[model samples]
Target: MIADAAKKLRENIQKVIVGKDEVINLTLVAVLCEGHLLLEDVPGIGKTTLARALAASLGATYRRIQFTPDLLPSDVTGLNWFNQKKQEFVYRPGPVMS
Candidate 1:
């Protein structure tokens, strides 16, 4: 059953990302293991495309964050701000929440 799902996901992602069977398989493994994947490579290598395709295949929301040395935790996890009109705090969700 899980294998079927993985195959389907791989096929669907392949419609958008080609010549990356190994990467896709590794990605499926990571997802099945509930682990994280770090894709580091040169530009225009379809890293982002593969990510988006995987998310789309799984019906998951995709959020892209430009990580930088100056990026803060709040930027990824979200932050709370006071809503002057409501006189209360409002939480704004960030990429990690997606």
Candidate 2:
């Protein structure tokens, strides 16, 4: 079942990201192994593209957060808003939660 899902994902991702079959395969392997993949290379080699493609292929929710000097943890974690009707602070699920 997982293999079928992964094949479907790979096919879907190929539509947008051309070539780089090795990267895509490795990404899928990492995902299946329950391990994280470290793709370190020079810029413009489709690192972000590969990530996005894999996310797209899996039919999974995708979120891209840029790490910068002004980026805050709360920004990624989302904020709690008080609901007047409920009279309580609601914890909004962040991108990671998705």
Candidate 3:
């Protein structure tokens, strides 16, 4: 079952990614082992593409956070806002929450 699932995932991701079978396999292995993957390379080298493809192949929710000099921690983790009706502070989820 695991092999079948892996094969299906690889095939699905291959539909968008042309090559890099080894990378795809390694990504699958990492995901299966509950590991995180960090793809660092020159710009426009398909890092985001690979991550999106992997997420799609695995039917997982994918969210990307672009860090900039002006980005704040609250932007990623969200903040509390006062609700007028409730008269209480409500935790608003950020992009990372989804």
Candidate 4:
């Protein structure tokens, strides 16, 4: 079942991405292994497109955060806030949680 799913995912991604079959395959392998992908390349290399394609193909939630000098860990991990009504700390999920 996983192989079939992976094949379908690859085919779906290929519709938007030309060539780079090896990269796609490795991405599928990484996903199947419960890992993440870190894409670092020069600008306009379809990195965001590839990630969006993979997420779409697998029906997964996708969120992208552009790192800047001022980006903080809390921005990705979220934080806890006090709820006045509830009088308790509420855990607010961040982009990484999605």
Candidate 5:
């Protein structure tokens, strides 16, 4: 059953992505294991497209965060801010929260 779902997702992603079964397989594995995927490669290699495709295949929301050397942890995970109206701190979810 899980394999069938993965196969469906792979096919959906393949519609937009070219020949990269290994990448798709790794993505499936990561999803199954509830892990993260880090695609470090040259630009214009379908990294962002693949991620967006998978998100769309799963009917999930998509958000992009440009990681940089100077990026803080709060930037990716968000931070609490004081809401003046409520007079309390509230968490603003970051891209990872998507």
Candidate 6:
């Protein structure tokens, strides 16, 4: 049953991503095991796309943070916005919070 669900998920992802079944299956294994994956691949090799595709397949919210020299911690955590009318700070959730 888990295998079937994974296969269906893969099929759903394949609609958007192409030519990477083996890698997709390997990534799906981690997902099935409820473990996070560390994909150490070069740029433009579909790593991000694969992650996004899988997230879409499972109806999960997807977010990508690009690590760069100038990246800041708050970028990932988001900032609190002040609502003048309410006179209180409202917390705007980030992608991670989503």
Among these predictions, the greatest TM-score belongs to: 1
**Over the stretch 1-98, how does candidate 6's per-residue lDDT look in tens digits?**
98789879989888877998888888888888989889888888888888888887888899888778897776778779899999999987666665
Cα deviation at 16, candidate 3, in Å, is 0.7
Q: Which lDDT tens digits does candidate 3 get at residues 1-98?
A: 98898899999998988878888888889988999888888998788999999877777888899999999899999999999999999998888897
Model 3 TM-score, all chains together = 0.88
Clashing pairs for predicted structure model 1, backbone only = none
Q: lDDT tens digits, residues 1-98, model 5?
A: 99899889889999999998899889989998999889889989999999999999999999999979999999999999999999999999999898
Best by lDDT: 1
**Residue lDDT tens for model 4, 1-98:** 97788888889999999988888888888889999778888999888989999888888899998889999898999999899999999999889999
- Candidate 1 structure quality by residue, lDDT tens digits, 1-98: 99899899989998999898999999999999999999989999999999899888889999999999999999999999999999999999999999
Poorest 10 consecutive residues of model 5 by lDDT?
36-45
Per-model TM-score, in order, reads 0.94, 0.72, 0.88, 0.86, 0.84, 0.80
lDDT of 5 at 22: 92
Superposed on all Cα atoms, the candidates' RMSDs to the truth, in angstroms, are 0.9, 2.6, 1.4, 1.7, 1.7, 1.9
Clashing pairs in 4: none
- Cα-based lDDT at residue 94, candidate 4: 83
Count clashes in each candidate, considering only residues at least 3 apart in sequence or on different chains: 0, 0, 0, 0, 0, 0
What TM value does model 1 have?
0.94
Overall lDDT per candidate, in order of appearance:
0.94, 0.82, 0.88, 0.89, 0.92, 0.83
Whole-model lDDT, model 4: 0.89
Candidate 2's TM-score reads 0.72
Better of 2 and 6 by lDDT: 6
Ranking by lDDT: 1, 5, 4, 3, 6, 2
State model 6's lDDT.
Answer: 0.83
Candidate structures ordered by TM-score, highest first:
1, 3, 4, 5, 6, 2
Global fold similarity of model 5 (TM-score): 0.84
